[model samples]
Target: MTLGLDEEHRELGASLRAWAAGLDGPAAVRAAEGDPAETFEKVRAAAAGMGLAGLALPASAGGDDGSPLDVAVALEACAHALLPGPLLGPAVSELLLAGGHPGSDAVVGLAPGAPDLVWDAPSATHLLLPAPGEDDTWVLVEAAAVDVEPVVALDLSRRFGRVRAPWSGGVAVTGLTRARVRRTTVAMAAAEASGVARWCLETATSYAGVREQFGKPIGSFQAVKHLCAEMLETAEAVTAAAWDAAVALAADEEQAAFAADVAGAVALDGAVRVAQTCIQVLGGIGFTFEHDAHLYLRRATTLRALLGGGDVWAASLAARAASGVRRRVEVDLGGRDAGVRDEFRTRVAEVAALPEDARRAALVERGYLTPHWPAPYGLGADPVTQLVVDEELVRAGIGRPDLKIGGWAAPTVLEHGTDAQRERFVRPTLTGEIGWCQLFSEPGAGSDLASLRTRAVRDEAAGGWRLTGQKVWTSLAHEADWAICLARTDPDAPRHRGITYFLVDMGSPGIEIRPLRELTGDAMFNEVFLDDVLVPDDCVVGQPGDGWRLARTTLANERVAMASSRLGVSTERAVALAGDATPAEQVRVGHAVALATVCTLLGVRTTLRSLAGHGPGAESSVAKLLGVRSRQDASELVVELLGERVVLEADDPQVAADVHEMLMTRCLSIAGGTTQVLRTVAAERILGLPR
Candidate 1:
């Protein structure tokens, strides 16, 4: 979660964090305020002794031969302790040197744009600057050759200075290029920003747990809980972005610049925002210099500024995306599933050879359609087998039929239903012969589904039950042959205990479906009225008064699906809209690209965890929350780009489609769970905030 996924990286990060903590970083920063030069020298020497300076250099150069990812892991740990001095500059300089430059061991300063101001100039023994009037050329000059005037910086932990020098002879560094230098710098800075964000989140959440107001902890309050939850989301985003950038940079991929731009766009700004929120959570104490909150805020802000601000990064990202550059995200798998993959590929190929109309039935017959389900119904595929099936299906150009509500209904039926119930529903649903609609939510109980008041009374004479309820926001209700309903079977029982799960025939005499038109003028959702509908005893799933538990049942055999590309539908559309975009539009597009990519990375991390035999991490839940924002924001940006055409009934079909998409995305936050409620859940359940 702290910019590393594997055990080795975790151990490295932990070791570095322990080392940094022992240094008393805050005290070091305070000491630097009085004697900057001496403090930096001492800190630099200690870092060197710890082998931190040579982490990114090759082993041939008497270094660790660490990749950018390893250096990022180390940087994240050091920054978590608020380690003072020039860690990023020297590491990035060594990365650029690639162990070829003779001055690799020296404290190297980075002059990204203007030579007048150089980062870490006060502590740097040499400087890397762009060659005069040469766009791609770079030069390395010794700091002793220039007149260095130390300048006061916002970040007291690191030093910056003005370099007074003429455009003269210097060593031409062939290893350096503007793109590579910028990407490397952004990747390292993002790692540091992630550490700052993580520390702020941890500090604020810890304080929230014990900080008292009135008669109890402030964390018990909904407002404070929501704030802490938002902080968690932001901190997670920063970590994901930073991690991905480091990975791409280390791989030396064609999309490395694109990934670095995303990191710069998301992590830098995200860190600053999280730090500010941390201060807000800490109340009056955070405003005083005695608190460490301001220090993190200063570091985050400085990183964003030195990297030319998030807007510039976002613009560059948008440009790259517009040119069709996309980052590929996939699990390495390490050939562990080679045999299974070959078997799946062969079976899938057999299915693919069939006529288009015969493929669905063939897939269902072989348990290829729902591979994650238990045998007979599916292959009972593990995560690796599931991925192999998915790849083979895609490779064979065979798209599985969407089960819609059946996907949810059949799982419960399989888990808790009678053998006869599974026989009646599972296979038929998979074969697309039976359609399902979920009738769980009522007008008054949407996200708080346990509050549903739909009643079911025992029909003693008829040997059945009489059901009466009003279900809202039911998708495909008009087309469904049956429904999975939750009815209050015992009025005397507790709220959650009284419910019963029922399989209702949608064609029953008293059922009525009313289409509910959305802002997009579509009727995809509906209201279903069930009045005195009869359901036999055989229609119920599990025992009576057990609907709540059955409804919440999540089979361990859940399907695993991953995005094929980092750019999602809305993000791709945003890129298409950026052809003639204004500067403001480009920034928005870039921000959208960064968010979408982070969402993908979160999934990638979660998938990686599963492949490694680890339990689910925070990424799964966090992905849902961030995904809604990313989709909604991208769609809104698309409509905005369309200008007046979005509002007008224009001849352009694309404009209307864009407008519709923008409106339809409004339901994303409200569908599975409202954003406000999810934030509360994230705080209480994930962060362990008091209810």
Candidate 2:
């Protein structure tokens, strides 16, 4: 199941956002709190005015005549702003109407205390209650028929009224069946839970970035950072699961049930964890009545139990899965192909066989090498196949082969390179005969790559061009055979339009390479001074002024590459680390491990999307940020578990390695993209914030 907003869906989001942005904002939500009637009316009016009432309504009804996916879209936007009863009412009613039930003047009653609750019983036209069995079947009742008695709720923006209905007009859409209703309601519940989880994360994260303590934003501290990161991840998992379920519901019934089950369990878990961690991150104020964090927490606890809890879903899924038990199957790879499980034996064999460079040669011979390169370049594996290759490599304890030149530089050439250019560079990249480095980043231009100063002047005398400038952070230039350089080929045009991508040989005269010392004391990056480095005209990639667009194909893929962690560990590490530690230490370790596994899965899920042409988008940035946070948490767990030894040199190899890894983890945030940069990227690109 796929989850994303296409162009039209995005347009719908913008419209809804603009409408909601005009409402009272937090001030309105705050004002309406406690005054159930006033708040419900205000929120309800706003929601109805925006067509939330008819979002999933069929054309036969007085509705937008849309799909359930459309309803999911509207619900997500409403969830983002913490919109109150108004949006919830229509959404619930629309669901009822979509299911062919009589839903007018009906309100949806979510399980009590659902965080991000849009359910306000007093204002709902009908209320939907969960009745669990093989599928989620809800008992719907008219608001008038409900013997609703108002109950005080933690969140003032929403109010709950206990409802009892024993009436016939509360008709079940006969053909829809109990199982189908259960699936839909569970999916909706999961979606709403995700929305709440996200809100908590966004709230805590924004606060962390600004709320200074001890002369620094608390977010700078590893403790606060880890908590916020966990919150973000919890939110992400819920969102991913919910969307997966929603899309599945739209596409297939059985998958929808599985998706719903997964969503319900994960969303409930995520909502609760995110809310609790957010409260901890916010400290004292987060616990106060004046703060909104508690409301979300209360809602999370209530809603998690409202649907069949996580244990119930887990049991259900487990029971179903166990019934499918079959013996493990094996296939012939002819000592050529390897499955994920073959890693241990494969690694032992690879290490034993390697006398010197035979291992590299074997990798190339076996087709596992350069799996990321397009077909003609080598293994010809697509991203999905590449992921499988990566997992096998990591499991086998194999290090990533040095291929900055071929793996990174050749893809763009294959996509846009002239036939001559591809013939010259492609095969060599796979064979590892030629090494490459990128020369795009500069002091003045980082994210803004097109605003570069490097120039490639026409050198008709040599039937090529002469380039002269400095390029910073050029990895592998010291050993590079060539560099794929982006330079100003038509300086008179607009910044983005004037650039050209060129292939520059490192052996060219006047090109000098110098390694830049890093905090880690590794000179992995270099600054290259290109002084009249000549490049033949045949080396020009694509057209003269299409470099900016071509560069994206390379740069965007870099995020997915970096996200592919070679140091693959598991939840077991986190669990074992804290078992013998103090209480605080155990919680820290447990949280980190669970968080890491969750984040790793999220990374895989998002990578799948990016490979599908969704681009990295905001979702990728969120994953990257979460990855950095997970690394930090893992580092802290190691440090705390080791106690005094981390602060002092250790004689034990394992202890020494732990300390080294802790220090290395510091660079996690600084690499791929900084946490700070990714946050702004999320705000601008994902959240639709202004520049």
Candidate 3:
């Protein structure tokens, strides 16, 4: 889905898409490639007439007076068609002219340097050239003064011409007007990338669904389906990144710089990757000149090269993050939250004013602790309400104790447990009086949890059930007061069936906990031995032989929190470590920043889906899959940036921490769900591939 796009943007994109579809974009691009000077004066004139050249310019200056975001929407639609034109360059020039340049009606071509690879240079009346040694400052040169040289580029759909020295008619643009031009250029470029990725995704998916192989559609094949799924994730990321960049630039927020860099870091890569994957999914036909896939690929790659690649932008983003730059998402409460925000904020403030020790109790009592939970236990808070409460609490300097295992356990208990079970466990868990741990994973049953061998036999004499099993990788077992566990209850039943879900007191006799040191040199995880551990009938979370279904609740909770929370770890670490980074290092840090931003956007989309009464669909799984990769990559970058100090020294605390964090991040992929397993699931379940 396109992130944060309103109806106007959607219609704008649709209208352009329709217009380009009728023009046969591929044929036009092919025509342009064959003869660079064959000047489609009519086609360029058509785009200009449609206001493509002046979308962001003011009506006073004879233009649409659109915002940066509106121009971005138009560019994306244009990119979908691989439509050949001087749209981006002209948009830059018009925005410059609207910023108070004298020649508002002149056709302008924008080039970063000495007019090398500049669009429409031979055709334009003027060229907008950046000043040699100044940042965000440019010189407007009349086209007739600079001799133009035509050349072929990787993207055959677009024409390019170069212009060099000894040119007069130079007018300088500095200050705010120059800065706006720079940022808007980056934002529009990102939007173009986003459009390219979107087109690739739609083309590949549509092709895969119809293209047959071995008597079935290729989309039915796991490999093709997974590739398409990856393209979907990339496309979504590009959209989110581009949209944020556009919004930030238009709003002129402090986040504009980092947002622009993030867009640069993510959008260009996504465009290229998605385009390449589109070709892969389409197979041999994708590689042929007859197909339009190569055109988009060329455009994606060329744009990336021109922007100096994702690494360059990523490194700058990292430095800003290090300097404490944050992209605070500006949300307009609008009519949706306006009615409830004040009352909710006021009540939240009242509870927050209480003593720190008493705040948790008050929050639980007033249903502010877990707003998403049902009434009597929580406020049954919708997404909007929850956000309001979060904002209010953060404002008041109040905090709630994280119910780690309780987040999953309490939800399971609320959904499947009895009234008595809910009364006894829910409040205490939410109030921070009781801590919980999960004993669901073992050596053999982590991802394949159905394969658990731990047995739970009914014991009549003790008047309960006895659980005997070895549960490994149980975090907080050394400190938790209780645990929600899964054990096999029926030997005759299928692997997925015959298991039961139970809550056991950690203090129960015959329970043994052994700390397991990790690669990070920490022992937060432990091996628990449950030899003759007794759990009463009331402790059964649901009916016997229902563990598999109940386990899904726990996993669902894990998936919800997966990308959102883990995203901060590497980002915070990267920010802490990135101090005045070199260009190369900035690229790496920028990559991390972009990934972090995407992770946040994914969460926002998931939340929007939840609020809309739709399941997060496959994107939720995609988030976890991509998140693990991002965090691991980011973690490795940290160590790589440290040179050889990481390998040579453990005495330095900072070095030691970096080393430990680097090693610990390895588990990111292995834990929750292995990257390989999740990809397969996304292919089969999300992308609708054959098992």
TM-scores for every predicted model: 0.95, 0.57, 0.86
Name the better of 2 and 3 by lDDT.
Answer: 3
Model 1 / residue 35 / CA error / Å: 2.6
TM-score of structure candidate 1: 0.95
Clashes of each: 0, 15, 4
Top candidate on TM-score is 1
Best-to-worst order by TM-score is 1, 3, 2
> Any runs in candidate 3 off by more than 4 Å, and if so which?
34-53, 99-107, 113-117, 122-127, 130-147, 164-167, 170-179, 205-233, 457-468, 489-495, 531-534, 554-570, 573-576, 580-583, 605-620, 640-653
Q: How far does residue 223 in candidate 2 sit from its true spot (Å)?
A: 22
Which stretches in model 2 have alpha-carbon errors above 4 Å? 1-150, 157-191, 197-238, 241-374, 378-402, 490-493, 554-576, 607-617, 647-651
What ordering of candidates by lDDT runs from best to worst? Answer: 1, 3, 2
The C-alpha local distance difference test score for the whole of candidate 1 amounts to: 0.87
lDDT values, one for every candidate? 0.87, 0.64, 0.77
Error of 1 at 616 (Å): 2.3
| Candidate 3: tens digits of C-alpha lDDT, residues 1-691 | 5543555676788989898777777788877765645545656777877767666777776677888778788888888877776777777667656755444356788774233557767557887776655666677777787777866789776666875554555877655344455566778888889888978888887888778888998887767877877787788788878887887875555578878888888888889999999998888999999999999999999888766678777776777777777777655445687888889789888887787788889888888777768878877776667777777777787776889988889999988999999999999998878899999899888889989988999998987899999999988999999999999999899989999999999999999999999878799899999999999999998899998999887423222221232337666776666774566676677788788888776676566555454556545666787787787888788787777777788689988877777899899888877776776676666555565
Q: Residue 95 CA error for candidate 3 (Å)?
A: 4.0
